[model samples]
Target: MDVQEAVFLALDLTGTFVFAVSGVLLAARRGFDITGGLVLGLMTGIGGGMIRDVLLDRVPNALGQPIYLAPPLIATLLIYLIGKHVSRARIWIVTFDAIGLAIFSVTGTTIALGAEANYPAALLMGALTACGGGLMRDAVASEDPAIFIGTDLYLIPALFGAGLTILAEVTGLLGGVVSLVIAAAAFGFRMLAWKLQWRVPQPMRQWSYRETGRRMKKLPSVFRKPD
Candidate 1:
């Protein structure tokens, strides 16, 4: 295969493994059976790519290539065989998820650009590709996803990766090396965010009557009047 094809394959494999581990960890946490674990693993591995392809108006790559599915299947088996034997499942889950996010963000941007999509669309596609699998996994596992909660810096890394890819393309530096560097930078950012407990701050909305009443007594006249 050529360099581009090889890069794509690497991204696919890396994403598959990361997402598979995420699914497996969730299944283990929920005490799912082996079959359930396998199903979740498969969904997590290909869910994002499937969504990306559908949005891009193409057949899903995972469906067309056995390579895309096999690594995840192997991962499922490994998780099943080792089931909670060596280390903390949560740590594994987070590590794999971070890797998957980085890989998918870069790969999705590359694919979108290859399809001749505009920069904004490419960035959106990349973010979706990074988060879609985790969304599916959370929905299947009946848990709230971090994206909506603003608890984790999940989407930021994806955005950074996508933005970097677009910047690289605009600057005429979008080769495999540059792409990989961008992906790695995104991954590093995510790791740092996780370590630092980075969070997207939620905006404070206007206080409701109850809150207003509670605090109104303490405020000066200028600020106390209702709209």
Candidate 2:
């Protein structure tokens, strides 16, 4: 494959694998059956690309590449087999999701640029690609999507990564290594956000509508690291 093609393939497959891993783990944790796990994995693996492709007026890659479907199925089986035995499976799920977010964001940005989108549009695409699958999965699983609710610093890291990649391209520094590094930096940024508890900026005004303390405790725990 040409260099650009090779880079795209690597990032695409890696992101698919990681996202599938997270989806399967979460499905299993939520008491889903094997079929549910597989279905969830498939959706979480390709939902973002589906959105990206539709917006770009292209056929979604998930429909064309049967081989690309393998990762989610494999991930589902593996996580189902071994994930139940682990005490800290939640950590693994989140870690994989974070990695998936970082890689997919860059791939989405690059793909949008290929379609002649401006930098801002490309950055938004990147963030969408990073969060789209998870949002879909959350909706299906009946959990609130943390990205929109500001449960973590998810969207910022994605946009920053996409913006950095575009900046590199503008400065004539784009390459496979640079892309990979930027992706890693995005991952680190996410980890740091989790560590430091960085929150999305909200309006300074307090807007408490009711006594949410009792109701908040009843919400599902599927949000985060695994968001």
**Each candidate's lDDT (Cα)?**
0.84, 0.84
* Residue pairs in candidate 2 whose N, alpha carbon or C atoms collide under 3 angstroms: none
Write down the RMSD of all candidates, one decimal each: 5.4, 7.5
User: Residue-wise lDDT of candidate 2 within 1-227, one digit each (tens)?
Assistant: 89878887878888998998888888888899999999889888999989998998887778877777988989988987788686786787778888999999888888898899988888888888888998888789887775866657888888888899899889998778888999999999988887788877564332342334433334356665554
Cα-based lDDT at residue 172, candidate 1: 93
The C-alpha local distance difference test score for the whole of candidate 1 amounts to 0.84
TM-score, cand. 2: 0.87
Best by lDDT: 2
* Deviation from native of the Cα of residue 178 in model 2, angstroms: 0.6
lDDT at position 193, candidate 1: 87
Error of 1 at 51 (Å): 1.0
What TM-score does each of the candidates earn?
Answer: 0.87, 0.87
